[model samples]
Target: MVFCIRRAYRSEQAGFRAGKFLTNPTKAGRGHVNNLRYRSSTRKKVSLLLMLRSSARILLLSQAASSSFITSSSPVSRLQSAQFRTSARTMSEMTPVFTKDACPPAGPYSQAIKANGQIFVSGQIPADVNGNLIEGNIGQKTEQCCKNIAAVLEAAGSSIQKTVKVNIFLTNMADFAEMNETYAKWFAHKPARSCVAVAQLPKGVPVEIEAIALQ
Candidate 1:
């Protein structure tokens, strides 16, 4: 059997000769057992080293990819965070403007509200602090409205000169010329404006004006 032949190869006195054991063994036969063990061990060590190198390369690549991904996304994340903070500040910064110098509100609204570096003045009619209507000509009524708007702006940490936009409502279009002349005097900077005729105004005032301005 092949097993019996291989067993004989390990014996000191055996040599390959057909199926018989020779009396004198060759040099290959003498050292075959130890040489086979050394070669097998060396192959195992080489295989182990190759597997370790492959694993190390995979680990390094994974770490490098993760670092690159983080680097690419960092700026976008910071930008989004900054935008969110700005939006929050804008939402939370609204403050009501109130001063005894301005005509009081006729209803439930504030005279003005300041937010995000701007002031929003509500429509002002010809009225005093007690909401009493002022009977006046078209030009005088327009002047009173502008004065109320100015007072509101000052309360909101801004000034009439800072006005950026204006809206005026009139009960009659015939008074447009008078209103415009009075308006030109108050808003020397000539802020953008729109004027329209309305059916009625609060307190029967002939003119009502609202303004928006920088704070």
Candidate 2:
């Protein structure tokens, strides 16, 4: 059972060759078509095995042009349907951290930056909410730095116990012992750390400390 398009069977009549209409004795309108197809009113599939008494190529063309069916053997046609699909793994987004309870940043930066399930607290000094350097000994100033870092981490949804790394800047190497004593009490977990003696710190403070903590 099959469908058929009744183009004057090109193979039956050798005289009816491919594109024979192009050699018409007399030309017609610009959009004139060689409408050589017909169909049966009934929806039943008709096997035109009798009508297709010709070459395989002619039968192939007839089946394609027929209105009742579709063929999908051409590579060019199938290639047009090919698509490039790539699944891209997306991760959670990051954001900045801020807290009015902590000393405001003295420069053009946020107190912390939260990213990839972690929070990075910026370097903090012994300054009050008013941005004034707290007048005290090295131990007191170190405590203040820890306090500020704690506040910033709390606002960023983290804490000192979760701190993974710490970087400290000291104006005087002799103050390292005093800063460590204060820093130790704040971080009982003893997170990784590095301290260096710089020529000076922000606002001429004795110490500055920054930290990275897990969320």
Candidate 3:
């Protein structure tokens, strides 16, 4: 558009200079010469306005095309699309872990969910595979909880050795020592752990344990 405008301006100036030479001042009166100059000035003004309008239209079309390209091909737009696809794939790849070897889930939840090369085991109380609560002290209860976690990990193709984090909930803080005694024997790798005294546990159990492990 700019090139077109420059060309038109240059041609108009050249025509104006040529008109001076083309018209013979000696063959006409002063009034006749002024009238001819007025007509020439009017023609050039009209031509310039037409050229400017054409340039404006061309500029608008070029801007519209550029905006359309940016909307469809910008980096931010492409990145957002890729992230959405990755999230959907991760959600679809998640696999629920369940086994007859471990105690059944007491509520409407999976025993464990395996996703992104990790196992997320739900909290396990001191119960057998039949969902029967085990009768024993805190140490025995802790042992049963660890056993159930081991079973769930095995079902998900993971193991106690790979356990990365453990959470232990107890109804009484005094039971911490006994629970640690049994817990240390199971988690020899000494993964990160948190033990908190809660007001109560499901089925009135003294302790419950949950774990996370890398597959």
TM-score of each: 0.64, 0.58, 0.72
Quality of model 3 by C-alpha lDDT: 0.88
* Model 3 poorest 10 in a row by lDDT: 18-27
Model 2 segments more than 4 A misplaced: 1-92
- Model 2 lDDT tens row, 1-215: 22334333323333334335444534564323342221221111223434443445576677667633334545654555452111111133558898987889898999999876789899999988778888889999999999999999988878888999999999999998988899999999999999898998778788999999999
Residue pairs in clash, model 3? none
Q: How does candidate 1 fare on TM-score?
A: 0.64
Index of the highest-TM-score prediction: 3
Q: Which stretches of model 1 miss by more than 4 angstroms?
A: 1-80
CA-lDDT, candidates in order: 0.80, 0.75, 0.88
lDDT of 1 by residue, 58-99 (tens): 877998898888766788877888899999999899888998
Model 2 gets an lDDT of 0.75
CA displacement after TM-score superposition, residue 112 of candidate 2 (Å): 0.1
- Candidate 3 lDDT tens digits, 1-215: 66666667677666766665666655669756874875579587758767796878888888998898777888988899899998899899999999999999999999999998899999999999999998988899899999999999998998999999999999999988888999999999999999898998999999999999999
Lowest-sum lDDT 10-residue window in model 1: 12-21
What C-alpha RMSD separates each model from the true structure? 12.5, 13.3, 6.4
lDDT, residue 7, candidate 1: 44
